[model samples]
Target chain A: MSSSLAQQKADKVYRDFGLELEISNRTFFNDGIYSGQKNNYLSASIQPEYYLEWSGGEQSFKAVGFFRWDQHDNRRTHFDVRELYWQRVKGATEVSVGVKKVFWGKTESVHLVDIINQTDAVESFDGEQKLGEFMVHFSQFTKIGTFDVFVMPYFRKRVFPGREGRLRPGSEDGLVIDSRDFSFESNAEEWRPSLAFRWSHYVGVLDFGLSYFNGVGREPVINDLSTFNALYGTIQQAGLDAQLTTGAALWKVEAIYRQNEFQDILALAAGIEYTFGNVKNTGIDIGLLAEYLYDDRDNIALSGLQSDVFTGVRLAFNDTQDTQLLLGGIFDVERTTQLYFIEAERRIGSSFSGAVEARFFENVDPSEFTYVLRQDSFLQFSLTKYF
Target chain B: MKVLTITFVLLSAVVTFGAAQTPEEKGLNVAVKATKADEGFVSSVVDLKMILRNRQGQESERFLQNKTYELTEDGDKSMVVFNSPKDVKGTATLTYTHKIGSDDQWLYLPSIKRVKRISSSNKSGPFMGSEFAYEDLSSDEVEKYKYKYLQEISLNGDKVDIVEQYPVDPKSGYKKRIAHYNKDKGYRLEKVEFFDRKGEKLKTLTYSGYKQYLDKHWRADKFFMVNHQTGKETELFFNNYTFKTGLSEDDFNQNSLIRASR
Candidate 1:
């Protein structure tokens, strides 16, 4: 009876979706330009999801479709199927099939272990959105832990903005490259099947996850540094993510061991977030965050966070509208390169919100990848209204 | 927050009494009795619409879904997710209102894809830019405040017991709050008056549209809060309430807030 009642409460053939229209003005402060020029443009996207769910049926179906249009960047104007899946739960086992997004990680600074779906890079630089992948998945929840296995049949490549978008790697005395000028490692494309397994459970106050994946890498190996051409590589990775909540502090760690054609590397991010309830008797709150990121490959790593330390502060007003600020900086522990960033957000009302972000790079080394894009320091503001 | 939570040890500092039971004990007894009158609700889910009117009479509206789960020990857990005003849609807040010490609160921002813990110091701030304060969202528990019976009086043609309560936390925005309970109706809360730390009336909240659900439980379907200092008002209209939702504690945590809008 309770199961039927829960089904009744969630019964639906058509669920919910929304349209978001965003306009951004990007400026590059430098004597030279590499990929995208200083230009302002508007982008709009619509996501409508459908669910064929029965009040008493054991099987359920869902589909989500997303499409976007950009004013300047041709590659940004595209469409994707975020999710289209069917699932069923019987006793302790659950099964699902079709295209879907599976998230697998813990930690704030980066999502090191979440690699089921390829990132829709043009959507945002944050690597949060994922393009759905075709897969057959199964999971079993038991008293010991929950174990999941996946058989993925296809792959999706990472996309970059058109020649007009901002934040591209500098090449050959600041030559701009088009997003269309992209290639693969070889005859390899999407169609090969991949295998993955994950186990997660709560041990006392700690929630931990162990994942093993043997698939085509989501991130590309920079084959040609001058024009920044991406060559997707095959990789086998074992990842571990864990979090321990103790009082007002949370201990977070994300570690990944991976092997590709060029090298075998182990990377880790370990941090503790400790919060002090009220600051100076004011209702506003502040938190101190410190994390250390390390990679065995060190300086030659593409993204260049190797052997770095990041510390930041978070402020929360805790009002009904929810206002917050996060400011932090990452410094090379063994080098002179440092980067600082600020991210803030607040609600305008029930229907709208505003966000602001700023990033500045200082003392970048010539050998580091960040030196090329040193002029990309920028401030971004966006106002989004829901419909 | 743990610092202020540690200060909650002062709650045990209430002066003890001897022969003549003081007004403090009497007011607390009334509160405890009223709290016990409606128990074992387990869980509830409700939909609410909030209307805000400025002093100039311009108005705006917000829609949300609120879910509450009762805890036999510690505090009750509640989650609220915005459903309308397209910009703020899918935003959610999860609160654990402790029986003692400070409450634990977190807000989920979808744009940043992160969850932030709320500072306990600012519970008195306006809720959603509305007249209601953050503390107003709390589920009333006798332990959250220390009460003193003011008097028995007739308020707005109804006989009521006027009581004054002081927040246990020193960081509370209000110096004290006044609650008028309907004396003849099993001590039901009819109205509340909030005073700032400066001892000035800050806001007044009125409850009406009494509704009885599950036979024994009573809930106010309409709540109107007016900010005396700012000359603004917010009216909350509850659409429906469902009890015995069978919601578990796992549904009121950080993970739930991430998908609250979904």
Candidate 2:
């Protein structure tokens, strides 16, 4: 099968094929301030993407695969498929079924209520956090507004044993709550769907949109039926999302104020960005973003009932020399701890880019916390080359 | 002494005649008149195709299309259709402009199966990531810019006239602009140099391949602009020049922007 596939690809390449690859080295240095040990961590990732367009744009297919290896304090290696999807669009409707980046928000950095793709840093800490999911989406154009809806039947589940222990599937060492862990197998019959509406008027200037999605939050796991019934008394089953964009600013806010099923989450985010140039000119641009998340849950273990506030600013500078610079920072404020991060990126050329980032975290009462240390700082450097 | 007095009066009359028509005033009048005439001619519906090229003269993208434009004395309407690049096929954009206030716009994307309404204040932003802002594509009527005749200049070996224009929009990114127009082509603009708010040269737009359509109407087939600081360039090619489609204000309505096609 591999040889036949290779032969067909070779034949297609002779006709017309495009191939792109990216390799990067990422390293993180920590003074062991929080971990109580200095650590140097290195990770390398290789991503190869292939595009094949056949017969005058009739049938085209694109496939992208990613592989990564991490060398940390403990030698553990893992690799996963990032994106593998095929798309076919006939006229006003298009369909894609596979693992893909299902973006569903209008904000720049923070998606106030978007639940499609799991976030990066938040997902990285947990092995069960998967970015893409298996789903089928359909989009249609209309005179009043455009409509987009997707059906996700399978969800990636995170199996967390407890707050201090590692997450392992089918483990009973610690108390397990379904509200914190996402399981696709438990609710396989339940289908999650999302809808988006867009409307525009005037010299292509003004645009507005509203979106809706079902609950994609983690389901609660109740060992006893009475406990499940008690928790189920006050769960709201639906989530609400909406966004608006004018020429000057793009704004979006989302909230998941569901009462019962187990997770009570309310997240709100707003972002504003402005571009100065025409489609042809590469010039200076500025963007400002701010986001806040409030999660209220009873009987859940991780971070026990927490509210996080995030604010960030991004500045982009692009010149005709194929040189670009992006400088930004994000400040995360919680009740007991405050985290600040600043990052800058410079594009050397079309195929290469580098970035440096610094992160600092401070705990107010360090002496009271025994499990996790406070006052930590980490620096990271990365160089990426795109083929 | 009587002859000298008569000669001085005659000389003074000649000087006053010339002074009555200063070069700056004449240039402003010509610029305004040309803009008004152009706007009047392009007020109705027109079918156009644009070809974009890069600085290296390679065709970066080609838009094979037809567009319907409806304009009023104080407002304008436009609907654009994309016929190339199968990924963006069946995409239609509808825009409405108000003379005294902000305009409203909408875009229908086939892939997303949704129509998105765009806000007006973003008119100064680049269209589709191009250097041309949404306002740049609107009708360039006399009122859009305040004019000042700079000087007489020569372009493309033709003796031309130059005028400066400052955008009336308070939020405009450009401080001022210099335009070179062809005298014989109904004062049609040949090129323009845009200056930043700091009064430094930012970009230059050149119009070429001027074709005379409908005898009295002159149109440029190619519009190219280059950003001096950034090497990026954008070119627009106009083709299938069809005029007078008998379209009325009703045709430029929101419903028509999504459904109408030439």
Candidate 3:
């Protein structure tokens, strides 16, 4: 036998343990009247993972768990549990079950933060909450390509009590109906399945996926057509999601057209991000994102009220071993406003780092539609410790 | 009967004299033979733990690591991982051999969120502040060196064969290397002398503490190398050596390097 083959046989005879953790502090600033008072926050999170593989075997198992606590200005402490899951592998097939962050999209930097649901602190949909669902997923690799599919049976229920705080559109108080809330007659009501397809070639890769459900997206409610017709109808129309990545750029576009019960709406979104430079390290990344959301139930033009067109440019420097600086600005074409952010990070050692960031929100309305509506200025500094 | 006895004695003397060849020739033959025999060992995926000693010759730091190495016909490619000191753990370093030229390299820092391809062309550069240079730690196949028999030597009371080898790669920072090989242990290399680009002795690498595993393979548990001029020393401890893992080329690709721990 070859020496490498012998080495492979030897690797199957031993096992080891590994662990990692990260702690970070984040603060938010909203100077607009809608944002309430300037709030400072500190949060510490711990994520632990373990891997086990039997000797002289191809089977392996991995488990991960996370816990976090955040302290706000009101002395209120919020605790969060993130990423609890177990994965098993046998040959070319891998399976994962439980609550885990599922990432979709090929964009270098995802811009439609609202469309995607997962746990992230950097760019959450305004007033959006982390959503988790109990799911089981299977993936297989073959010479032809790689294929993956996920089945989520239950959904997370999110209810926002009326509060005086910064609120984005589509985040208003509402009672959502889904598997967690209501019982329906169809099997679709029992479980929602998301399908993803990926094809990789020597030159590039392409990925696409679609999620179909009763529309509550994990919200629970009684499926009474009469009482909850408006919301129930939207849940019936499966949404279309897809992403494409090739060469130096990646793009993702998604649309949802629902006409089920009481909900009648059409929403379309598109985002394109391009990376330029040698190996995409020290270069410019620019993205264009636009969304059109229409609500016909109320006979109101929600599209014009919620529609937004944004263009952003990011300049990355010193992206190698020592230091990194990122300067970027987002222009809101519909709102006639601009937001600029700058972040700089330096490595102190292998496990420790410090960063400072500043952000400014400005009104650039040449039309001068309304000066009072103009929003401006926010800044924050943070330090992170990775274990 | 007396004449037959004399002929047998002459034949035995000739055989004994041939076995007494210089250690240099034996060491060179062993080095060449070992590489030729292991040609099919193309790639290796392993978990490594290294203990770095301070200037006082005392263990000062420990690094837990894992990596997948691709030993190609051209050169060695590896995805190095650091899982400690929180900031650097998830980072991966990718080293690839240039198809028609020298080894090309790059590092992907997750914290910085960028892939920085190495631009430096120096092979003798220090590797991550260690005593070993980038060239020395690389996978240098037997074909890269031309060998000549040197002399016989005794180390720690064990007779060893010594040989000198000159690197064929123009980018190599060494004039030649002198190595000592043990005759009984599959002729495994025991020590090596590295010469500077200017043809001067630069460093010495010693392999000790041999252990047999699976009744078929012999491994050196401890490897210590000292810089001749700088007086700096580095020691590598191989606690686990596995074989026949059945890893494929797909497991050592670029995406695997990035999403390794995940």
TM-score per prediction, in order, is 0.80, 0.61, 0.56
**In candidate 3, residue B138 scores what lDDT?**
65
- Per-residue lDDT, model 1, residue B122, is 61
**Tens-digit lDDT track of model 2 for A80-162:** 45556665544444566777554444444444434555433221331223445566656555555556666666544432222
lDDT of 1 by residue, A1-387 (tens): 277787775563435545665545444445435544554556666766665644333456767788878777787888999879887755456688999777777666777888788888878666788788899988777767778899997877777766666655656565554434555443556665678999987654577889999878787776666657656667899999987766567788999998888768899999988786545434466778998988887544557787889899998875556788999999999899998888898878566678887878889877777786577677777776655
Runs off by more than 4 Å, candidate 2: A1-38, A52-60, A73-91, A118-130, A158-209, A215-252, A270-288, A298-305, A321-334, A364-376, B1-143, B148-161, B183-188, B195-262
C-alpha local distance difference test of each model: 0.76, 0.51, 0.50
TM-score of 2: 0.61
TM-score winner between 1 and 2, please give it: 1
Sorted by lDDT, highest first, which candidate order results? 1, 2, 3
The local distance difference test score of model 3 is 0.50
TM-score of chain A of each: 0.88, 0.66, 0.63
Q: Residues A18-67, candidate 3: write the lDDT tens digits.
A: 44443455444544344333345455655555555543344445455545
Q: Cα lDDT for residue A95, model 2?
A: 65
Q: Which candidate is the best by lDDT?
A: 1
Best-matching candidate per TM-score: 1
Candidate 1 structure quality by residue, lDDT tens digits, B1-262: 8877766655444434335558898889878878877777899999999998989998877789999999867778999998766666778998878887667776787644456554444666556657776679788888888999989998667789889999887767788999988776657889999998889998899999988787778789999999888788999999879899767665676555654545
